[model samples]
Target: MKPLIVKLGGSVITNKRRRFTVKRATLTRLARELSVAKGPLVIVHGGGSFGHPVASKYGIAEGYKSKDQLMGLSLTHRAMERLNSYVIEALQKASLPAIAVQPSACAVVSGGRIQSMELTPIQKMLALGLIPVLYGDAVPDLSKGMSILSGDQLVVQLARELGGKRVILGVDVDGVYTVNPKTNKNAELIQEISLSNWPSVEKRLTGVVEGRDVTGGIANKMRELLALAERGVEAEIVNAAKPNILKRAILGEVGLGTRVVAR
Candidate 1:
């Protein structure tokens, strides 16, 4: 069976308003929910408060320009690892065989896009019934010295390369909305988005989002997921902050969140 790819959005897993603060209770609950999955799984997570704040502080996303940025790159990678540790610990406590796969260690990019990655380990791990966890990180780039690899982009690459069945993005919002849902009470939820109607939907999407997300935020996520849709892979953006929602979404329940389709 193909593995299901689940991305734990930064805002859902961490307190984006605070630095290095992991929402332990929420993460544990989500991990427990993930433990119910009966098949292979791959978890990709966002940087949120941990990595995003630090990355933005030193302009890590713009790539290496000065010798000072080398330290920024190092700090950024360390922060992501720290966040990944929390995720790995939570999944382990929930009895899910999860292992952290550092993107920086195995991936090289050019212009903030994946160029090559060592996937044999992840493939073998999946074959052994272990869930491989990955996240957005700063990685070496051919065009630039280093770049930020967003979890959204990683989901697209992994699903396509590993032939994932479906991708579920566990986000703070209930689903995609006409505007920034957090700030706009009038924003309407967009339950279904497809390639044909995406242009229209795109016009209504506001880039205004919470946190210091250096990785292009929700708009970039939509673009990335749409690319996956173009290849016939479907994805969902669900309110992972809600109880049982992530579990249900992983179990194939529909109508709980926004669904992005190829058509």
Candidate 2:
């Protein structure tokens, strides 16, 4: 079987309004749930409170400003480290042999995009029955010196390289909707989306509710998944803000979330 790509969104893992805070109980529960998966899992996570705040302030995503931006980049990396450490510890406590890998160390970025990703470490980790956890981070950019790469972009790269047929995103919302549910009361939950209706669906999406994200947020996520769908890979979005939904999605359950089908 091909490896599964799962993304733990920042909204699901942390309080976006709170600075540098993680939802430990939710993460631990998710780890325990993921511990039972029988297939190889490549987990990619968003920056959430840890990365987005600092990077947004420094315009890191804008890419290669001055040496002054280096301070913001350094601070972003440190925050990612701290957040990843907590996640790794939680996964380990759940008996999942999860290892942390930095995207900047292996992936080459240029023009705010990943030009190349070194997948050797991820392959080896999966072969050894371990989970490889990747988080959004600032990476060297040939065009600008460095750029903030989003986890959504990493999911597409992982799925393409690892022979993944599906990419799952656990977010705060139950699934993709016709409008921003957080604000619009008439927003309808879109149970399924595919190439045929993607253009319209893309029109309905609302960007981030809170938090400073240099990455394009949900808009970026939709475009990335749409690209994957065009390649015959499907992406699922489930509600991770609550509980148990993420575990269920990881277990390959369907009908509980929105499914992005190939056109």
Candidate 3:
């Protein structure tokens, strides 16, 4: 049984461009499916349409301003918590034992590195057969004051630390593509990527999307997360919009997605 770390993309949950509202049916289905999974599980989700656009609207994206940053941070944190509660409750209703642990509360990042990850509690819960859920939000940083930690980045770090044999990142697209599939119909899904070939992938990503889009985006995410694969931690990017893919990935069954592994 591999230690599974599944990242729930914000876009899949909420339409951030509009306003933050719970995608009730999707979350309900996800919770139902995850409840019966047979393995140690850790879940992370993005802020989606709820917190991010608000932060961007108030200029919170450019690192937090002391005053507005705090306000923005408060808003962002609350929004994530709201989503977290909804997920947790749904999981509970589905008979899945789960707990929500806010990374900002116990995680400490110094000099842009995860200096420490206090995982004893999470480990304890997982050992007791409870799923631990984390999300992307504002976390404290010694140098930058407060920083936004994407759920994607958090999963990469957690997968490395937990030594998961594989990490499956469910995203909005088919998989890592040569171009944003939305804009470029010609974009082809690349089956595999390595750290060495990432430069070429990054170069080809011009204007199809923003860096942050690529932050959680498959190509760039696979690049940053390649270190885990180097250590023999397999990873993949799949479309989260699909209803049943998560269950397939959890079962170690082949499903739609680009698999990223060590070359």
Best by TM-score: 1
Q: Give residue 156's error in model 1 in angstroms.
A: 0.6
Candidate lDDT (C-alpha), each: 0.89, 0.83, 0.74
Between which residue pairs do clashes occur in model 2?
A: none
Per-residue alpha-carbon lDDT of candidate 2 for residues 88-124, written as tens digits (9 for 90 to 100): 9999999888999898899988898888888887898
CA displacement after TM-score superposition, residue 252 of candidate 2 (Å): 1.9
What local lDDT does model 2 show for residue 122?
83
Clashing pairs in 1: none
- The TM-score that candidate 3 achieves is 0.90
Model 2 clash tally, residue pairs: 0
Candidate 3 per-residue C-alpha lDDT over 1-263 given as tens digits, one digit per residue, 9 for 90 to 100: 45788877776776655677878888888887676567898999888777676566655445546686777778878887988898888888888888998988868876445678888888788888888899887777777776777787788878877776677777767777777787778887776667777778667654222224313454556666787888888777777678888777777765368777667
| Candidate 3 wrong stretches, greater than 4 Å | 196-199, 207-220
What tens digits encode model 1's per-residue C-alpha lDDT throughout 172-226?
8888888777777898998898889999988888734334478876677787788
The candidates, ranked best first by lDDT, are 1, 2, 3
Whose lDDT is higher: candidate 2's or candidate 3's? Answer: 2
Better of 2 and 3 by TM-score: 2
lDDT at residue 19 of model 3 (Cα atoms): 74
